[model samples]
Target: MSLGDEHDGQTRTRLPEGNTGDPYATPRRPARGSRSLIAVVGVVALLIAAIALANRGSDTPTGGSDTTGGAGAPARSAAPTAASGVRPVTGKNGEIPTGYARDEQGAQSAATNYAVALGSVDMFQRGPREAIVRAIHDPAVTDGLVKRLDDSYSAAFLANVGLTPEGLAPSGLTFVSRTIPVGAKVKDFTNDTATVEVWCTGLVGLAGEGSTKPVTSTWFTITEKLRWTGGDWKITGSEQTEGPTPVNGDNRASMADDIAKAVEGYGGFTYAR
Candidate 1:
């Protein structure tokens, strides 16, 4: 079949050098559309950083909202507390937030956070990578996911971006891939299974001077079809759509070193409803 050309709105154009796009626009949701998710398995070498500046504060007041996946949903506040308290539960592995999300919103939180862990830069390392795969992905899909990622972050691919043999970030360089859920809504949430859609902005890139792959922020929606397995939510299957995306405002970009320092200094919070 012939591929469709990218209309300014419908098409998701991948940058020729590095991955960059508005993560929140609905990129023509074909049943099997390429979600513009140009995967970031691990950081290989010196790279650029992915930074999602908080525009909610007085500084970031462009009201950078769009109509992509979950449109007109007021927009998740940057504050820590809300009616839905879905904090991260400390786990044996690292941190897995659970408890208090009793409805569809809760389920959405669970699914979104799971996606965060699954899409983290830590997934590049060997041990943590496997643990995350098993943690968030469905058992049936785990093997297939691994195989695909292996191809996606192969030796040649890693070399192009400057990673080590197994996709480790070069020393002193910080690799970041964080998905901050703006909000979530449940189409059908139950005690067992829930379908949740998360509005998210993700940071993907490396941090350092002279880096080719600089950090970039993306706005995208992750519609998670979560299963109530392992005493918590696990992804059965998920689809990604681009946007509720907005224009790249003419904000002054941060310095490369400052970007790295900010990523390191700042702590990602446990999202609550």
Candidate 2:
């Protein structure tokens, strides 16, 4: 899916009104004007000095005298880094990854990984799609979502995207559908539930000789409301919206064979934090 565009707005500043009686002011007023100018300059100088001092502290090396214990910068606390040191899940429920932790970081990791699973090429196939839905979604919603998605990816929809009724690409081509999460955040979270938003960039289409549906990239955000169940985070619901996209770069597009080769060569990551 693709996102809509955003427009930038301009800002204008108005200057303060001039003193009306300035033209006929007394000669002594010139001294007052000088005093005022000096005051303003002093304020500016003070501001510059303060900024320089602040930046100097920031620029100091970790090994400097200011560091605690003079060993280096203070060790980063776990609160900010959130390093549990727990290994990520190495198992998969069918094609979808499984076994997420039960914290805010766990919720974020689950959401990002689920987004990748749901956006994959396998989601077009009946068996794999059902497995994925059952794997990622909460048990309460799995059946409903599976039925809805089955109806949504109908035969006509498959044909429109140049896929067979069985959801397979033609023999000569390889279908490409993969989501790469750029980042994720928890919008609302508690011990039992969380709302997570994942920003992702994806590639979708067919890669092959004379391919009309050439691979293309898109940006979007997926918001998943998750529930902690079965000792893991499972999505209760999800909605996608257009992205905070950037302007396209000047890089030249690659050939279909190269695209196919690259997809095969580079594997995707299991995201965290």
Candidate 3:
């Protein structure tokens, strides 16, 4: 979702006059035609050559032997897939995850987890939203940020997105909003401060029979400036931009009921690396 549309205090892009529609349901086109067989073969050859050249000088030893039956070439560094075994937080702050480490990797992990919290549907409500803000944000800025967010999630915005004035989905309808981090990078780092950018994709909207705002997905990047405070990382401020989005695939859209069922069955994750 656009930060201006539903998440943050930035100025929003106004729809054209009288253009009241579900903005998330933008039309999609079929993917472009594929390359010819010969073209594809040539491209694959080039890619193989490039990979071989790139890894030619790597020093890490590989498990397999070379075609000439000599010691194998070096292997590339493995990508991170699990937690670093850093001690985890012992508890939650009103359902917000906490107790992050006080280092660069810890900062990246904190930013990723915090992005999930901030982009969650829970942020649409008052009490959980406040708890989330207090848990993830720096104490120095929490009060002011809470007020800013309260103003941003105005009643008009809530009503526009099919929420009650109190930010609840009407009975029988489930509002789905979740952020899944694809990856995170430390832009800058220091003992007491860091800036991290987390690339994420999300689902948002209302789901139920006869619902107009069927859930839709969005891609965005959240950049957070953080500080080591209270023995862990806390967000000092943050901003979001459209995406590092890729071309859309030709997947068929699911029915609202199926989408709702899938969301309920598939739980979210606690991101760490």
Candidate 4:
């Protein structure tokens, strides 16, 4: 996911000093591994952002819709969208769940599920990548989209990120890429088409002993253009933008084994609106 690019976008923040004798009063420089982790995570973040920027369709907006008052419209509240008591989807297209209702709630549900599929570690592999694209994308755009994604995940790019050409990690290492949707809301809805925004936080990197690229978390929002076709909602196109990122908290990072174990222990959910 990262190539150790020469981008220095990290901002170092210092916590307030408690007391002169306090051990935390004097901040120490991060270890060499910590520095590498930060740099690699930044590179991958930029890489994903660049991909989203390039793949965006002409009709897609560069940002999420503004909730503030505009064009004489009343200001919309910033509160989270209320759930509509919709149940989780009961159908499956391969491993991906399908069979969404034709409404705003269904559109939001589709967008969130698609976001998870798009951000998964499976997307790195060719076989699973094709299955995911075919399952979730509109049929008319599926082949072209698959080709584009394959090109994006070329062998050289995989090598740069410490994975094999087939997207497998080295011996004794585990690759992790998972997207957890924070929330989803419909932006525009119609009988056959809808636009939805899904806010997500994801983990992406390798995890294991002596792994230089430790797993890292990132926040991003994905905008999906969905069309109700073939008895289910399918993606026409999508875009992503860097987050409504929160300030970094003062928590110590966990060990790589712990991350790898957690990823394996916990299962993902079938998100619903």
Model 4 Cα RMSD, 1 decimal: 15.1
Query: How far off is residue 180 in model 1, in Å?
Result: 1.6
> How much is the lDDT of residue 77 in candidate 4?
36
Candidate 4, residues 200-256, lDDT tens digits: the string is: 777766789987666667677777889999988998877666676788899999999
lDDT by residue (tens digit), candidate 2, 24-92 = 000111122223211111011111111121222222301112334556558532232233334445465
| Cα lDDT computed for each candidate against the true fold | 0.51, 0.58, 0.58, 0.62
Error of 2 at 12 (Å): 42
Could you estimate the TM-score for every candidate?
0.65, 0.69, 0.72, 0.72
N/CA/C clash count, model 1: 28
Relative to the unseen true structure, what is the Cα RMSD of model 2?
A: 24.5
Each model's total of backbone clashes = 28, 0, 0, 0
* Candidate 4 or 2, higher lDDT: 4
Identify the runs in model 2 with alpha carbons over 4 angstroms from their true place: 1-86
For model 4, what is the error of residue 196's alpha carbon versus the real structure, in angstroms, after optimal superposition? 0.3
| Candidate 3 structure lDDT | 0.58
Better of 1 and 3 by lDDT: 3
- Comparing 1 and 4 by TM-score, which wins? 4
For residue 17, model 1's alpha carbon misses the true position, in angstroms, by: 36
